[model samples]
Target chain A: MPLLSALGGATWRLSGHLARHFSQTARRGERPGGEELSRLRLDDLAPTALSAGRLELLFGLSPCLLALRAARRRVARLLLQAGKSGVQGERAELLRAAEVRGIPVLRPRRQKLDALCRHQVHQGVCMEVSPLRPRPWTEAGEAKPGDDPQQLWLILEGLQDPRNLGAVLRSAYFLGVDKVITSRRNSCLLTPVVSKASAGAMEVMDVFFTDHLAGLLQAKTQQGWLVAGTVGCPRPEIPGSSEIPITSCLEFLWDQPTLLVLGNEGSGLSPEVQASCQLLLSILPGRQLPPGLESLNVSVAAGILLHSICSQRKGFPEEKKRGQHL
Target chain B: MPLLSALGGATWRLSGHLARHFSQTARRGERPGGEELSRLRLDDLAPTALSAGRLELLFGLSPCLLALRAARRRVARLLLQAGKSGVQGERAELLRAAEVRGIPVLRPRRQKLDALCRHQVHQGVCMEVSPLRPRPWTEAGEAKPGDDPQQLWLILEGLQDPRNLGAVLRSAYFLGVDKVITSRRNSCLLTPVVSKASAGAMEVMDVFFTDHLAGLLQAKTQQGWLVAGTVGCPRPEIPGSSEIPITSCLEFLWDQPTLLVLGNEGSGLSPEVQASCQLLLSILPGRQLPPGLESLNVSVAAGILLHSICSQRKGFPEEKKRGQHL
Candidate 1:
């Protein structure tokens, strides 16, 4: 409700002026000259827009086209590189989508596009759209006990990097995770950078957010869901750490519904999250790693872990099909 | 030999003038102010140093420290952000390594460091070192027919992005791929950007390059090596594609020494490379994918594929151990 209220307020304010300009430009069939729009800033138009926080400027060909196709966000305007009006294929498809939707298509100079995206690769396309708000976990319908036992939900705890979060979401979606839930606090909110990094996967995926991740895990456990927390490696060196049995991801069998928790980049799972987990999963290095090279990047690790667990599900190819049936 | 010759020539030339200034500054205990060093460019010092092609500017604490410790390249100088000289921990360790090796240390403005790395994240530390040259594949020793049956070598064919190349290398090294081979023709070279992206794994991993990747695969196939090439999916729609047996990566058994070949980001394996592969492996998506989201990122795919194949090796933990033995 807070997310919806905030988004509604921001969108209402933004659409008042910017949306009017966009529709007028489209109706007049006038392309805004680069010089005329050089000093235009989306934040300036929306006074409360906190530097890419309130209104999102999604860029790149995939993110732009997918954002339009998904229709998840309220797109205000579409900006294509000035000389790319005649562009075919995906860019053309994007133009047609905007036309059909009556969204203004602005052919801005590449510099304006570049400045708009802060020099991130725009692929000659940028979109001014309402921020895609992640729904609160309370709004996510709970899976019944009789629901698919092979379901897997990815729980990300305190992931700070947008690119890492984006990559993780891409992998989670591609691997067919039943759901992706992240701690709302201290986690990277859905952003343009995340969208671009995800190759536009963020546009399509419905990610749920919750402040009480540990409580959610505990509740799910009572509903016959396995809570699996990821650790870089088992550390027996720390006293009393051996209480939680660590299973190598390859050795762990996926036989039931599960919530797989991934930790932040610098630190592993928090104590509360770790305490709620029934199992600890680790990816064993193939060989002895040198100091400082011991851990894989958080995103890479997520991809590996997701693949390992998801591939073992009942949906995999016949050869990998196990005794467990749906 | 070409790689070595190029590296030797560049190192010798860099050591003449720039190396002297670094040592003199270190010896005199004088810090060059930002204004005096603002216009200095590594390329300006060496006229032929084609913008980060010859002399490498390795950055970030891990890559710098590992490069120094690896002793794989000639360390010319170390650059730490101004006022960070008295820092402790990893930065201090880097300073010590430079001091012990008589590699002069320079304290430059953050802007200078940013410019040197093309605004890439340098983590307040940068190093001027001879490029770590990847040896030609021909220089790599031939693996005999009776070599370890569990050996897995990652072969990359024409990966274009340095970040992708770096990520793959980091995974390869972390997952314990016996060797990493790439086509020298179109593959991203071993650059500092790669080093930083790899999180310093590039400093320790020796990547072998060859012009004729297909010919090498053919040669390895003759040596009782199973050549496994990756495809996005089995496309029975493509005429005559059914002839190449494409197995799900989960179902593929790693019974012998294998060469896993990953292709370029855009277009996968070339016909020549595909023809040389005895088996095609694909990661099966968990569900029906929407259009434009069918394929995983090349780097992400590599991680998943590598994890799937590597985890099945005989060296895995007891639970994952199979009948195959050393």
Candidate 2:
């Protein structure tokens, strides 16, 4: 009944002022050039953040069986909830995938599934996927020179929140970032909370895990990617220290291949990582910021910065055109 | 030991490279052009997110006691965990505030505090404060005829996540918004989770809650405020309808007192709200978004829009000034 009401509401709105609003013009169907759409479906089964330590549980029939079939990581087992709606399609597909992988499948009552996940909401279907392992840079073939200089690479220094990780990844993937490099030592490890927060972008993004961030940054800097890092501290004035150039996020230019770095939530940058950055970028303070409330949430900051760079790179001209429409 | 370790780490880091960074510039002895610094300590008692009914629990010594003393809302009770350190100032202050208000203060074991909040971290202090009640629009002086036309107002419709609510409020407050308006029917209440997520912004922000959002919007429109709303679907193909101007968020002007409305996390503006908006704004899409992921997280999208408008209103002389620094 609720779903019916929601759809009814959506339809009613679509026929009214929204109809006029959306009829302004046509949007170009072409995705501004990247991988072929053919491989888009292959990433629907990302598994890194779902399982924390050992076997992880994935709920919902489509996400589980899809992950079993398409995830880069392997599945160890499947746990299907007994007696639920819309199981035949995923059940058949799940059985086929399990047979192909030689994995085990178990049918468990809903209550049992609830017990295993500490009373988390597991929507009918669940799977025991392999534990998360950090992906090596070598797996993506970007380390030994000749990598695309224009490729966007982000180095996250010490993000703490799992939800922030998911949000940033979704934005990064949407904005055409090539890959992400993060360290687990001073950051949130990929977990189920992160996967759910990502709303499925975790399945598609290319993330390389690292322990030696400063060292890798030095290497990347040596390779001539314009190394930039974000800082929120309003200008720390060192009497004798030379000023490094800082770019406002609004006016930042993407003239070269870039490696953008973000600092921890509370602490902006570790001294070592701060030393590695050649360019400092900032979201610039707006008027009347409440004390102790100056900086934005880490994930929100990421979305804004990624949007700025991505739009510039695409040469997407909309502001003036949109102004004209107004 | 954990508290000692956390403080030790904070102090140690505070003196190192962080010292050099902070010592570079001295903060203004005054908190800019706002209230006197003498009253700054009053709001330190905000509770962490916990309550959904009549009262909520605020954890940590400073936030709980200070909230008890200074919050416009009443504190029903204070829960003090036995066997914790650093209670001299806040404890003394808390007891005084409770006596003045005739509220009870309970000294409970740490286990009891944990149980009360469903196993949330309490940091040895907790308080039950009054539940949220709708604030009348008259409190902020916006409902009057001669209110400042340059004041900024916001309307949020059907936001579901307490975290997003908190994040948006923090950003809105930091960016100099005058007040916020939200409806409760399809929205997350001002619960303890939201308070924690907001990092205490909820205590200070001037939020006017409304039951009849459409009616209030209509009234505000009649009173002459430039009203706008955001949509993310990116579909510009509703047939048989005439064109309506859509402003890209980047170029949207903040020339007058404005009321910006953001809709539901998933479904976006109900048709009624869409009809009410004189202008429509969108966070422009970047290239090659994942098949199922096009929109950014709500809080992130809010941060970007609020930043844009706030910076514009401030007329921050950036482009060349920042370019030169670059």
Candidate 3:
């Protein structure tokens, strides 16, 4: 009973229906159309379904629920595991949202749902929704010299990992970043995996993209915005690196509108992008690091750097107002 | 040629051997014992192989390399992909370490290597090594009142996710935490996945474990070490609250020995554990969070909190002696 309670009463009711359905399918020696559905791949559905504007199969409870709530994309169908009549909480809310929007809700077998999501942990929910695309930087408006000093925008150049991108977005949104821009050229797009990895932050945040990252940095610099590129622990051994002055992230005060640039996971910021920055920021390790363990994960680094900069914002709690000091 | 150079000269040499192996296997209508090896599972060999002290199949280039370098456990065997004779760089280093240890190395098919690691990017290497067990808290030694003023130990209580544990270890090591202790009960173990997720930090860092987390906290508190527990955004609306005064992590100065406690992912610190804290630490969000987007990922929070606390340690660069202020 405690297990049932932990699982929730709705699951208890749904279990009976699921059991009955499984037994019925087994007895029939066929799963009706379930077998065919379970083998369906996203690529196979690309030509027709995606062309019809249902671009992605967004899965997971948080992503699906948030996607529906955000209403940024059109939800063509909501796929719930068979026998959800007794479902409650978020799943029930998802169903209601679909109903309010007149989106068709389908009760498919769990196998079919699994196949639709490429066997991701969907939590008994998936949706056929339009892709959430990043807007161009041109639409992000010009940065004037008199812009808010506390404004911070995160620029990701050539980040290839979807999970890292998602984690960065989650941190950016949570840390109150004014805008997020990624290099359109070698950046991971806003895929469903990214949505799940972000814990659904991707559903709410508006990300901008640009093919010309270095140009944007130069333009922002000319517009009186500080462009700070992140580099790992100072590699003074590298030739021709002494020109750019790198400051410890903690020592660098955020007193003006700034663009913080993060680079690719494998190879860091390309030379052209690094050259466009007016300043270079680096996180100093508390102790000497082992050979291969020199740098922090990009997402973790982003979180630390963003927290350091954003905490210095004008209205941050208990800091400027409360006169608290470390 | 450029692609081959980027992949390394060893890969170029290994390609012909791999092509020959694949073609030979295809012509033979068999995989030459690889079929059975590919089907092998850890549980299937637990009764015999583990009883003989071969415990875990540590995979990934980093973990395998670090495990070999650390020599912490008795490595039973090292399995490299069949065509690795032509491999250089880290792979060559790994082979040299194995040879130095006099450990047997097997040249298995890539499919078998994949199966050994459950298909989680083994990078053409796998190792059958003894388990890396956490030491008891008793072995961690007592915290004297006159102990180093800047000592910081990360205490993880009931952390369930392997990846989170790994990420925390990676951050803890990178940030230079003095020691890491975790609750033995209801915690994820140091599995291969954890090792891989940690970027091989688990192979090098010595983690301590305790059955009674609260007891250890109380004992450490009595020894003049501050026990600080992390909490989410303050809930002024909780019915029976207000005893613990949570300080902003940024505002909390780390001038003494401290134990930073992080709770589980879903349900945070258990009630009993929360009561054992001398102080509570909370990271202030930069802006108002929407519903369900309240907290940061645990590992990211760990990195931020650890960096904040660790940055204040005595002799930290650019902080104490440099006279730099944010």
**Model 1: CA > 4 A from native:** A1-54, A81-92, A109-115, A235-240, A318-326, B1-54, B81-93, B107-120, B235-240, B318-326
TM-score, chain B, each candidate: 0.81, 0.71, 0.81
Q: Ten residues in a row with the worst lDDT in model 3 chain B?
A: B3-12
Q: Locate the minimum summed-lDDT window of 10 residues in model 3 chain A.
A: A3-12
Error of 3 at A250 (Å): 0.9
Each model's TM-score for chain A is 0.82, 0.70, 0.80
Query: Between candidates 1 and 2, which one is better according to lDDT?
Result: 1
The reply for model 2, stretches above 4 Å from the true place, is A1-54, A60-70, A76-125, A138-140, A143-150, A235-247, A317-325, B1-53, B60-70, B76-113, B121-125, B138-140, B143-150, B235-245, B315-325
Score candidate 1 by lDDT.
Answer: 0.75
Tens-place lDDT per residue, model 1, B11-118, is: 223444455565565567654332255455443333223223346567788899899899998776788888755779888788788889887667777877776665
Ranking, DockQ, top scorer first = 3, 1, 2
State the lDDT of candidate 2 residue by residue for B218-291, as single tens digits.
88879877777776654355321114457777778776678888988777777777767777777776564533
| Candidate 3 clashes between residue pairs 3 or more apart in a chain or in different chains | none
Instruction: Give the range where candidate 2 chain A is weakest over 10 consecutive residues by summed lDDT.
Output: A3-12
Top-down lDDT ranking? 1, 3, 2
